[model samples]
Target: MNQLNKILVLNAGSSTLKYKLFNATNANKTLALAPMISGMVEIGEVSKVTHKSHGENPKKMELPDANLNDHRSALSLVIDLLCDPGFGGLASKSEINAIGHRVVHGAERFKNATLITKDLMAALEASIPLAPLHNPANILGIEVATELLGDACPQVAVFDTAYHSTMPASAYLYGLPYHLYKDHGVRRYGFHGTSHSFVAKKAAKHLGKPLEECNFITCHLGNGASITAIKNGKSIDTSMGLTPLEGLVMGTRSGDIDPAIPTFLNKQTGMSYAEIDSMLNKKSGLLGLSGDADIRNLQDRFRAGDKHADLTLEVFAHRVRKYIGAYLIQLSPRLDGIIFTGGIGENSWILRNKILKDLEHVGIVVDKSKNEVDLTSQIMSVESSKSQVPLLVVQTDEEKSIAEQTFQVVQG
Candidate 1:
């Protein structure tokens, strides 16, 4: 029997640090679907830690007043929780074999999961300009993990933009001056690559084909959404560009707006660039249109006959459908599947119905009954029998993907 190695995956956001601990086979690096330990730390003036441990006897605990001001302190608290008898109760920190971090942007420098090192850390710092809002937090997490866990445990950086790094110049390059891209690295670098890559592999397996032989359009719809056109297992193009704000309409982001809108708002409303940036990134999308950011709340209002809510849903679906159509043409002549994953994509049948409606002419059809079925436990195809292509709802497991990648790097 292959020995099991403990792998910890951490996703550090601006204000939250989410983590999951998996037991993976040391031989093949196959990860267990259910994490042995999963939790998150909410960082602020008064921090909070929510923890869950799974086994024969499951356990859960919440520290509402965790004394953690930042990611470092929060991760220190996590170490304690892991060793505490009542919590994860591991023998010691040495039991953790490897750590995987979800680094949001790797730019063009790091295109694969890499072992964390001083030189790589320097490279990540240099790429910060490409992901100003996310990379710092991710770097902080890596630093803290290294500090607290020490050099005994191997650490790997799983990049979100790495999977999309396969995109050609025509897809990633902007129409701006060549020197801007050549000098300042101004170009599209898609996000949510781990999710898209995870689901695409699963979609290929579902279609009984190797990933390199399959062509797919993957839609990862959540608070932050993006679509990818996958050709022969590589990302040919994706919706998000440079930052995550260039793709589909998101929960709090005004995606795909005119490039001059910021300056226009600056000129018209006397709003500073920072203010306009804040408005677009934090106060737009469903929130901007329907006065709410949560899709469930927006759906509630829509069912209650709210016109603004109706428009919000329509705009969101329209943008997604538009991308689907574009990707269909991009991946023409034997597209194996169209996959929907992430929070909104997996749960919101109404939105899926809206996005897929009238797409039958292109051989895409959603089976209403199958679409409405609960997908919390398993992946399912919601496409009709008459459809030429399969429409799949895949449950994306990015943490597992990270763990698998991390284990591979560590083993090598």
Candidate 2:
């Protein structure tokens, strides 16, 4: 075992493979924090491969269109480009000591990142129904990497649901049929584990407090949104349920509605289950709420007095506020502060104003001047009190977490 530093982190979606290779040496040794080399290869109805080395702008990898048949080929091309020196590629395949994967769901089976093995892969594949769209791609990437790297280089699986595995039964269970709940493993296992975990840790760092002593709520808002109740470094509860489709109104997914919706719509439109699922998962959410899914579009429509757009934003903000207050009440007196991360949470000050506005009665206030500060900086706080609960805006780095876990596994 040598001084482990470089780590390759892979984040695979249904049709996109995004990656970042990080160099993490002993923090005390050198000041040159290794650069992040990243890119995404999108392979779906339309195919495109892109790569960016050392945080530079991505170069279009002109891969042979016909040869790139499936996910496997996509992975192969990615490896080649990462090794290509003409581009920002790391210039050597051997630079990656270990690979860490972003696995979407692990149910209750995994509480932390585990080294990927044949048995673990099978278990991950079995959990596919719980994450029909995400886990398969992640698993595919692991297999492809293992085939190319072999057992000599360890690979790790970091579950998105792992952080929320600490949720108490009261928060995770639903009053559905007992058999369905027991048989299908259909219970609320929240997603966005790594993002929430990263920001929560980031909050602790910014607050200059021991991570184990911090209690906070972290909202990861983006196209996919979720709020996590972090009590002393563990996820006690979260907004997302058994699936990512259950919580916040995402860019293109319906979060929640009446349980009888499918039956009612079936009778009305005679749509099949798959068709309805697609509509709810793909065609709904902000897109369904307003006329379009783009937040800018929503903003434009709202300014133009589009009722639905305004209403949609209201519903979105309302849900976030509800969760904040709910967690406040649930966690009570021990609550320290709230943290925000992810795309919308970190960048959208308007959203911060909407969620944090008028919360003075609950001892929450925002100094508009501080709120308007540049988002690129961390530790964003609006209100300051002598013993004030901190409202922090942290930019999350889940890839670093993945690499750290991968390093541990490889070292072991």
Output the number of the TM-score-best candidate: 1
- lDDT: worst 10-residue window of model 1: 25-34
Please list the residue runs of candidate 1 whose C-alpha ends up more than 4 Å from where it truly belongs after superposition.
27-34
> Which tens-of-lDDT digit does each residue in 261-285 have in candidate 1?
8988899999999999899999998
List the RMSD of every prediction in angstroms: 1.6, 2.6
Q: Residue 373 in model 1: shift from native, Å?
A: 1.8
User: Over the stretch 151-195, how does candidate 2's per-residue lDDT look in tens digits?
Assistant: 877788999999998899889989988787789999999998998
Q: Model 2's lDDT to the true fold?
A: 0.80
TM-score of 1: 0.97
Per-candidate TM equals 0.97, 0.92
